[model samples]
Target chain A: MRPKTLFDKIWETHIVHEEAGKPTLLYIDLHLVHEVTSPQAFEGLREAKRKIRRTDKTFATMDHNVPTIDRNNIKDPISAQQIETLEKNCKEFGIELFDLASPYQGIVHVIGPEQGLTKPGSTIVCGDSHTSTHGAFGALAFGIGTSEVEHVMSTQCLWQNKPKTFEVQVNGKRPKGVTAKDIILSIIGEIGTAGATGYVIEYTGETIRNLSMEQRMTICNMSIEGGARAGMISPDEITLNYLRDKPRIKTLNNLDSLMDDWIKLASDEGALFDETLKLDATKIAPQVSWGTSPGMVTGINNKVPNPKNFEDPVKRKSIEDALAYMGLQADTSIEDIKIDTVFIGSCTNGRIEDLIAASKIIKGNKVSSKVKAIVVPGSQVVKYQAEKLGIDKIFKDAGFEWRESGCSMCLAMNPDKLSPGERAASTSNRNFEGRQGKGGRTHLVSPTMAAAAAINGRFTDVRSFDVDLGEY
Target chain B: MEKFQTVISRPAPLDSSNVDTDQIIPKQFLKRIERTGFGQFLFFDWRFNDDGSINEKFILNEKRFEDSEILLSQENFGCGSSREHAPWALRDYGFKVIISTSFADILFNNCFKNCILPIVITEEKLDYLFKSTLEFEDYQVKVDLENLILSDNKNFTEKLDIDPYRRKCLLEGLDDIALTLIHEDKITLYEKASIE
Candidate 1:
């Protein structure tokens, strides 16, 4: 018998039919939708007069354009209209919706896992790229375009070619202060933005197995940044434990039998992969991106790389342009770079654990007078949990604005955006040009590092802060 | 979807790499439910100043490139965000074809669905195209999709590579939903069996 990779097993099972020359009709288990990308997709359904084929498998939420500060009223007319459109579409289609007023309202990725909608061996997709976040549950998840969204909404399936599998193995324990975010950023930096193109990356290693479910989600969330179609970590005790208390899982009658199947979903021994890369996790350090792309990252202790060091003219030019736009000097230490704002939330790092980590650092310290810091939880549940733990108070007492849950300052679809030329230490995923705001400079960092920057008013090593993590 | 057979039009060069979708169309303009009418908002941040005046320095705003239908850009064009709006905005803004050294996966796939041909050319060939666009006042190149060839009248031609499946769909003006509907019976069976 041929040994099969995990991706092959799950993908092959989902195939309705595949001919010699046609694209595979892959059945999708879950379809997550948000405000920004679903409007046109629903409109496509309306134009064609097609009803949603399987509303039971589809879920809608309003996140991207929702303001984190104000829950009752959205001041921006455009933002309000997009949310309203999503509500009308979901109601019309008879799909489940977690609107702004709903307790489950949060980032789509966050709500999916918390609700146990993302399950092992399931194939999930959303119009937003962070759909990869669900892959942490051992699902084959990836992002799709609006047209593909409409197709899935109408048919509960997609036309896709099987992507080759790439294995990324990280061995050894990650050094203290180095997180899943840093590890992913370092991997992206080593392999440039397009390195994993045309592949689905399966992350395997002792280090990966040891990570918490939230940490694994953080790693998979940025897989798209590395250009992979998706990233997956095989489900284990950690995954099952996280799902045990989830609402959906609690409704299951045969939990033990389901767990048995999930455990067997791992790739067989001697499974074939198209490519493999191994890294020593002990060597990874807290990373920061100095350029517009997530791949332009280096260890926090390192100096900004000079463009002249690049042999490729295209790379050299990109580095030069990024430096000019970011107001960065070549060979200068990253620690010396001052930031005007610090954002510590997004689908990438807005989980309860992430907020707890940031709150530990900010417990007794005040945010620097030179900086304006804000923390937005990933979901309303996370916000509620933080309040129960008094983490919100820790942040607010530290001079950081403890805002409501949403993708605030990540893409700046709302009022919480950086002014032109303002620099931010962000915990969100992408740092593309004008991603946070028009002409804003973003240096991607981890939650702890973002909190450190808030207190120091500059990019500082989290290890340098002599803080105790008591009862965090 | 329009059938894309051939296109011969003036090409404008955007000499930048990693041109993400956010830059192509800012998130603020993505509020509209309709896919059309995105032309005015294409590159809104770069093409216009904060005071609502045109920024003359941007290449698209230059008089010579105003009517160009083809865009020649560097590698990794449309790198961020899975917005179909990126391609829609480009097509709505009058771009019939995009030639780049490479394209981000989602954007590349979205182009075929919208009938906007995204051709992948080598960096060396891209340099030649960029040079030609700048050297000539009204540079025009002929893209023959049937033959998978890009040719300039003056001593330049390059063979492009595209998936035969995508090429056929583009040429036939077939959308994915329509094609998938052909297997609706099989899909229905699979869904019913899985539920049971």
Candidate 2:
């Protein structure tokens, strides 16, 4: 049977061959690189005396170790070294790079989409898990390992097996104050983090269909957290409209014609799925991860689940472990959890819209003196846009450290780390144990709710602050 | 290094939902890329105490699963980042079978390449497997790859669902790189032709 869903079509097109006892070899359309993961891969290339086969097909950027403060004074030698290493590697490999001084330089994920390098019906890979973010544009994008990165560097091909396809149909319009983050967190809560495992989650239905490009990106970006290879929505007029007239590649134009092939990517109404999950957008609310892992989320008003309430012994034990690690009582309200830091940016939540939404909540209020909040833009471009609208000044005026663009406290790659035992309310994805730092707790919230957490020093509903979130 | 028929073992039923990759192999242990030694650190964040003692409540610390080589996790196993360390750690720890309702895509593909058998069962079947293990004294599942069949001698039995070619690869213990090399002569001919 011919494939109906975009995932199947992309998979079929990319499949070099299918043989007994072997995975498929996919021809990678684009290869994205960064500092932390590329050093070893580039080192391997140097050792093997191989040049990047096709530099035009590959692109590079630096983000992981970029400092969030005093951008000009990147005094730390290691930080400087990482950026330098990326530049040197890209130059040696004959690949295009967007370094600090380059107007195109930004978060690797953010750069591809912003420049239209990422597009529908293509296969993309990066050495970062959040590479799944590109799937938002109706591409099959996912992260690969260093060895795999080296393999792709040497040969623009990946040894990948096709993933089973799953459909997550989110029906109904979102209620007020609910956001894309809430829709995803609610899905995580329903399916659990590993729910979409071994599948390319093709997000469908009216709700996902209606989301802005940025929101669709956010939704697909978190597909990793749900254990999907990548999450995607079929490109439509919204996608074409978003890509039109952007400062993208010179060759790319007229997305209207492109839509002909793009529209064929969605699953047919009666297409078979390995698994199907349905969600009601209207029922979701502002979500927060009270415990470790994105699946530990609940509505803003919900209480921490008691382990004893779990039916199964294994689940009970797991919940107990989370409770012990978080140092929270089972029945305590999530609203009561105190926080010391508030971070509102990452590839998952660091777009200009996220900043604008966050600024709306904190425009008039002051963050708690005890809370040290920082708003790091996903890219330098996002920073420029936010600054153009005075969003950065508003954030700084409300006591947020409006710092430089890059993945900061989200993983604490640079010096921007939370001390031990510090609790933070963040807009970035992932709340794994010590993900922020050793013994540092993280509660995932939407950017607006993160702003609320900054003001209140605990998790709170964004509605309490009374800013119209505009769209759910 | 090692070749085998499809890896066949019983998933040591851990009936918890949303088993994250971080919980499978935490970020603390991700500092290194040497994939071999991660077995010791598998579930380090979830299985150990802050003081480095085993958290007795964790499944790994349970006596019932001391010799368990297969992991039957609940839905959404290996969610989070596409950390290849997860399957490496699971394989290094000697887990051959990871039967679950679902798994994260990247890690799922990574598993087959590393000789880990990732099987997806229906949720009802998963519930059956989880509960059946509790009742049987041996509760052992035997996967015979040659037959492409899995059965617990006492009650439960099912065929492991996989793509036909993937099934062949698992049975033959071949990976994508190995598969590509199979057509090297043809590729060489094509390359020479293109050059000409």
Candidate 3:
């Protein structure tokens, strides 16, 4: 029994009704679908003899399975079929689709914010779990399954029980070497993966407020790492400023009027939470996942976790397995781990601001000869804006492959895959074994970290390789 | 379109922990815009051979669990990724109850809406449940929607704790759309009032 937080307020506003033990039905404001998770939902509709109820609420894009460099080459038949089926499904269902050739095509999480489809105090769902990326806008968003996808498509509402509220306040400003990604990674490591289960996290405190939209996005994007349904930052002057002048966003409410309502998005001073955690960001350092799960994280400067330190046999065995799979010594420093691939994209860090940070790290520097690097803009609009600023040229000049945006190398559905046992430093969420490719090991890091890894051909700190930013 | 009750023989054993949505329904299959024919591709990579033949090594291919309609799994089953296809594939491939010691937050939430039951049982009970599967005969589990109970001829009976609201929706087969239509009268009145 907690006082109403922003999550409760937003969820209650959309509540149609509730059943006692059954789930309450919630009206979904936006439904984002990508090629990888939509086909089945569309197929379910066909089987049920129904069509998409609201075409406007639903949007489709191809990202997970589309290749980055081989735009013209159709090397993999399975990848081609998946993309083709998505096209067929979208066309037949009359849903808007952003195919590969279309400039609107990008990561679904990235595209929603750029298009203003993501609004303050809205519920968003996609087939991709990192849809938590939308929570940066102070929206309640999470990944849904195909059946729920069909449910959203047909009715624009979903069955859900309101989750308990949890507030994570990070006091003090972040240290220079620490990014939002590092802070979240440290938090996940502290809480473990299932710590925030059945909770909607409201992040606050001066540290969270000081973060840029890109940095807030990076923090909120990985809420799933600690198993949150969604993570939200209260819509403040920062949120209002970010939404100003967006196209369709202005159609609903202009920025001036919207700010008046948006400021009320914070949790009340006396609001209660099922749980509360206060983090001091000043002490956090750059972190990396030593094991398969993102929660198996540690300071970049620290040695690998020893099995002797673990109390749970399951977790210890998992660490042992992970260490064996990752081919690392228990006491070896994380900085010593070399990377074969460095990907800076996906919903987590694929934004204009992410590119700006990465470019500063790789402005005149070159990627290591042994490392294959890719920079994917989160959205088509982000791509265009970055191109206008010649961010694309800076990356290309630094020898990173400039590719059309998609969930490239985040999950190995696309041609951008790692060979078996290949190690990667990725900006996307998730670091499970074989996540990037079958038998491919991924190390989750921020985009700047990915750039640093690319330059050194090993896990390194971006701050160490920083070139001067022109100005504020 | 059909209304019938199915009495499942028993739950099958899947020892693998942290079974992800990617493993259940891969990203490759997600490209299809439609939802049908997913059953065939369910567990495609795990249960099928490279040549599209059945991989006898897979648990789903075992004859002992061939008729099983329920799955009993380890902690954090369905851990990674939020592909709805995982449940669609599970339901389409004829699974109803996914009894696990624990489940991922996102996956468990998706299960109820997809008409799949995600039951959380005690670890001690899970140990007993896994042993109970050793004897295939008379291990039958009866799930009666009318009674809202999960029981067997044996002394084992577990009452499901579905939210009463969800119970109504599930028992009545009312999805979100049906629930929304219940407020039609109020909506109409509000619309009329707005115009006036």
Give a tens-digit lDDT track for model 2, residues A1-472.
6447888788877655456665676667899988766776787678667777668779988887777776656776766776787888888778899887776677888888988888788899997889989998899999886667877776667777667888999999887778898888888888877677667898889999989999999998888887777888888888877777567543555555566777677666677778898998878888989888888899999899988788977578778878887888998998899999999999999998999998998998898999999998988889999999999888888898988888888887677877777888988889877778778888898998899889988888776766777763
Q: Cα miss at A307, model 3 (Å)?
A: 3.1
Across A1-472, the per-residue lDDT of candidate 3 in tens digits comes to 5556888778877775565655677777789887666666677677678777678878888888777777657677877887888888888988888788887778887778777788888888887778887888888998877667777887777768778888999998676657888889988898777778788888889999888777888888889878888898878778877777566677773466666777887677788888999999888877878788888888778888888789976677778878887877898888898989888888888888888888888888999999989888876788898999999999999898888777778887777877878888988788876677766788888777788889999888655754653320
Q: What is the C-alpha lDDT profile of model 1 across B1-196, one tens digit per residue?
A: 7888798877888999889899999988888888889988998988999898999999999888998889999988888789999999999998989999888888988898898999888888899999988888757899988998989878888887778888899999987888888889999999889867
Predicted candidate 3: interface RMSD?
Answer: 3.0
Candidate 1 Cα misplacement greater than 4 A, ranges: A468-472
Give the per-residue lDDT digits (tens) of candidate 1, residues A137-219. 89999999999999998889998978889999999988778889999999899877888888899999999989899999999
TM-score of every prediction relative to native:
0.98, 0.82, 0.89
Name the better of 1 and 3 by TM-score.
1
Tens-digit lDDT track of model 3 for B1-196: 1222434667787765566676677666665555456777776766876567889988778888887888888777787788766777887888887888788887886766667777787877776676787664668777765566877767888776655655555556655555565655543443345335
Lowest summed lDDT across 10 adjacent residues in model 2 chain A is found at A248-257
Best by TM-score: 1
By lDDT, the candidates rank as 1, 2, 3
